[model samples]
Target: MHEAKSQNISILSYLANRFDTPVMAHIAFVGINKSFLGHYVGAHEVMHDVMTKLNGTRRLGLPSRMIDRLILVFTVSCCWLAAWLDINVLSIVESFAGPAGAIILLLLPMYAVRRVPALAPYRGRISNVFVTVIGIFTVSAIFYGLLG
Candidate 1:
């Protein structure tokens, strides 16, 4: 039991690192592990309960869904910041593509997601991607409008 828990923690840590966001990784781990550990620890008490127990105390925090949304927003903001900074790095793309191109880039992911049924199951991940694309485009447009 202890070994299994340790292994699960390791896996969660690995996933967290891979995602580059520990909170999101923890959310994923809780969501996925809730089902797997349900049988052993009662079906009614899963991730939330187990996490509380593991930590020895529960801390007040935003609900999981809210946290997920926040993560998406944060990711998008970061992407926007990156794109804004990239105007200095890739001036040529900004010069040629201009605001119109930026708008196209922003809307592209949303268009693809709506058109592609296969991406439905991964909506959360897709939303992150969409937001990122939108952020980049928005920043690019702003940069073009300001500089060009």
Candidate 2:
């Protein structure tokens, strides 16, 4: 993250935990040693929990698809947020006013994103099933487009 100079500490930790989990999961399936498994998975489970909570907000009746779109478009246009080069953290924060600002930037379009009936299925407070599909769609799309 220092390489990109991203000021979002939460995003930074998120990137780190995302990096570790796959390796740990793979290590487990491959029957890797216990010590190595413990080091990698334990290091990231806390963050897995945090990611789960942020995702839980959709369960509170908001999937905020536009925010997801903006995030995707941001990645496509500027390269992955994680791949941005030598970005100045302070300058970025100042440009948007940091996390409070970033979140506002993220959430400003909620009224619109949740309005479509196709997406209205996502309007349920119990979005575990709906958002799971949306989540799968987003990940497959972004992952294939960006990394596949």
TM-score, one value per model: 0.23, 0.18
Residue-level lDDT tens digits of model 2 in 42-103: 64455445445676854644355644554446435653454466455455544444434423
- Best model number under lDDT: 1
Model 2 Cα displacement at 124 (Å)? 2.6
Residue range 91-146, candidate 1, lDDT tens digits: 44445666656556666566566678986665567565767677686866678677
Give candidate 2's error at residue 101 in angstroms: 7.3
Clashes of each: 0, 0
Task: Provide the overall lDDT of each model, using Cα atoms, as 2-decimal numbers.
Answer: 0.59, 0.49
Query: Model 2, poorest ten-residue lDDT window?
Result: 102-111
